[model samples]
Target: METEQLYREHRSMLIGLAYRMLGSAADAEDIVQDTFIAFAQVSEENVRSAKSYLCKMVANRCIDKLRGSASKRETYIGPWLPEPVITDDGGSLEGDPLSRYVHKESLSTAYLLLLQQLTWTERAVFLLREVLDFEYDEIAEVVGKSSVNCRQIFRRAKRGIGEAPLATPSLQGKTMELVQRFAEAMQSGSVPKLLEVLAADAVMRNDGGGKILAATKPILGADRIIRFFMGIQAKSEGAYSFAFTEVNGLSGIVTLKNGRPHGVMSFEVRDDQIVNLFYVVNPEKLTLLQADRIRPIA
Candidate 1:
């Protein structure tokens, strides 16, 4: 097959894998582009499976990126959340690689942060086996490990990461209503109403990347989270307006100030309550969520 054809068919998948691995869509695109450019120059006959070869290339590059950026993340400001990818709401992702891939719960900010707990190699092995469903032999080839080693690594990574706390599909079906209620409560400044939608032990994390003010540590408990928001509300003086939208495949809120992008808030829902909130205010991360893509929720 021609390299251009291969790229068109697999670019979205490749970007998905790299984005999960690196948590940076920008980095993911760069790595995939470089990989395909390198792939095109290679002798096609020598490459047996283009998909597998591309997967290996992207995965290996992500590993290198993670290792190189380890120290930078360690010194990052506030809690680290994955770059927010504003997904389409019954529309086209058009210019974004995440359009086709962000629907999976694995692409959610909460789940991606869980993947951050694993070592670079373990992350590669686990994603290959679990997310992509690559066979042990295929994963072994991708990571340059023996099939036995790949299996062991995957098992270990699974144990370490544990299960994500995202809403199950059945629960997810009710998320829109829940988020709507939450938004209404916020707009009305109804503390009691807000409490109704939040888990008692709900936690909120803010990532400003040191560019803007944000909480340095998580605010635990629904009450505290409410108070935190209230404080921000008071300070902002009604400057921030929120719109309901899809974020990382789940119902979330996009905040705009002065008709410009402000931040994004993605939720983890379980048992009809918002259990965890990932708020990313980092301007660099907010660039993808253009004003035209968001609409206010009434």
Candidate 2:
């Protein structure tokens, strides 16, 4: 196989893998570009398997980036999440090189954040094994661990799965539908109906970056969630207003007050209802809210 052809074929998958690990699109591109540069420097005769070498290169680069990002993450000043991508197709990214990975619920922002709970190694292991269906042996080789180690790592991650409920129905269709309903209800001020959609186990995670007003801990249960919303609504008398937008593919509602966005909210759905709610009340996270909206606020 020609070197150019091999690189071309696996480029997107490598990048996608990197993005999922590091949670940054820009950083993912840099890592892939670096992978090719490193590959070019190595002699062909010295490289036995081109695909294996390239995949390893990207994975290592991502692991390094994840370490640095995780260390400095708290200083990021708000709810730090993956960059949102819009997708048209409904399948894994392995099919066509031209297909873009959508940030929608199936690959939604909430899911990406959930990926953060696992250790860097755990995240890589899960993405390769569960999402891409890579064999344990292959993942072990890439991650530089034994196949047994890889399986154990994945087992640890799988055990902690569903620790947080973000997207609904665990199905793409149901998630989108529930989010749309929540947005409309928020727009119309239908408090009672909105409460109906929230699950009894519903919990709200707010990231205020310690710079804005927010719950420092996760707020659990439906009744508490209802009170939280009511408190915010009571204060929105010309000082603030809410707008719905798509953030990282999940339905998100952004809060704007006196012409500036103060916070942004995104959800995780389970069993066709809102089981988890995340609000990024920190101003820093809402920097792109205006741009994320379907249309500019009037």
Candidate 3:
């Protein structure tokens, strides 16, 4: 009963933490499940502060997983983006109250990529202290570091990340308006219209994980990106349809080819311009999109 209650309360939070650490929702889910199973083994009377204990277990497990998978990610083909967690996909997550507890902004693909820059321990300390609101002492326990060392690690991580990925709530409306305009421009087949919302130095990255077709490198600059999109449109016209959905808690577009997952596009808006675009078409990463029943815009 205690383990079940703990699972009900902490499963979502643990998954969120693990996802941010590993950048794979599927792996995060697996880690959370494994953690709960381990939790069930320990006597309840021996556990102090169940939340802290579970978080520590999950965090350590994530650190180990990241270390073990470091070479795989380093050797990953093409541009690598986090596996997106879709919220508006008419899936269980859309109505799962547990999901509401996860911090949406921190889950953004951009943010998760920034986290990839940090070392595994640094990521753990920074996330525990900054994102999860764990105290220095608590973070220290989780990472097996002294509180002073944890603080130092966090400071280094802060410097590494530099700035937060998600825009402020005030800019959110503007971001959405720009995304709507972007979709309209794509549908209208107008390069000039697409250029209007894109920054001069806009970048689009496509991740295929070597399992599907994608750009081997980032498409740089607004003009180049627009040209690339136009080229794709000309070649695949009517073969793909796009639907607006929330990807990693930000306005994003999901492309469908014949009602199957083609790609998932997430954006980063700064100063009301689309500055960074991430297109994840890797068949492995599109599993969630495949499961969701999305109504494409005609």
Candidate 4:
């Protein structure tokens, strides 16, 4: 295939891979662009498989970025959340069941955060094997490890991250229902209603990047979370407005202040209750939310 055709065909997949790897859409776009540029410079005859070649380039670029940024992340000002993306199409892979399962889990915020705990090699190996369904030998090629060693890395990555809950389509409707209720409670400043919807062990985590007012540590338990929201409601009366929207393929709310994008709050629902809430108030991370096409949930 022509270089342009190859790029056009593989761009979305490559971006998804790189974004999951690096957790930055901007970086992912740049890496994919550079990968194609490098691909264009090479002879088509030398390329055995365009998909594999491009994926290798993008994965390696992500690994390099991860390695370089490890220390910087350690010194980051606040809890770092993955850059949110609009996954209105459900972000499913167009393949067999295994591919769809992997693609769906890999796109979630919890899974991405779990990945952050892994070493660069472990993350790459796990993603290649578990998400991309690459053979051990193929993963060995991508990460420059022996097949046996790659297996070990994958094992370690799995043990480190454990298994994240998959929010299936069956649960989306119930989850959105809870989201709407939570939004309504917040709008009405009803603490009792908010507590009713939140799980007993509900936790709220905010990533303000130390650029805005946010709890430095996670607010644990339903009472504290309710209090936190109540405080906001009391202090910021009429200063903020919220719109229910889909974020990262899940029910979430966008907080707007003075017609500007201020923050995004995505939920993790289990048993029809909010288990975990991720609030991204960091202005830098809110760029994608601001720029993306968002439709309010009715």
* Candidate 1 to truth, TM: 0.94
All candidates: TM-score: 0.94, 0.72, 0.92, 0.88
lDDT string for model 1 (173-284, tens) is 6777788898899989999999999999999999999999899899999999999989998898448678988787777888777666789998888787888899999988
- Which portions of model 1 miss their true places by more than 4 Å? 94-96, 104-106, 165-168
- Local accuracy by lDDT, each model: 0.84, 0.69, 0.80, 0.77
Error of 1 at 200 (Å): 2.0
| CA deviation > 4 Å runs, candidate 3 | 89-101, 104-106, 290-295
Give one digit per residue, the lDDT tens place, for model 4 in 27-49: 88788889998888888787776
* Number of the predicted model whose lDDT against the real structure is largest: 1
| Candidate number with the higher lDDT (2 or 4) | 4
Ranking by lDDT: 1, 3, 4, 2
In model 3, how large is the Cα lDDT of residue 98? 26
Task: Pull out the clashing pairs in model 4.
Answer: none
**Per-residue CA lDDT of candidate 2, range 1-298, in tens?**
6657877887877877887887666677788888887888888886666766787888888888877766688676445556543333234434543244332224566778779888888888888887667888888888889999999999999886665433343455566677667766766778777887899889887777677767767788988887887787787666655555555555566666775766666677777688878776655444433333333234
Q: Looking at candidate 3, what is the lDDT of residue 38? A: 93
lDDT of 4 at 30: 88
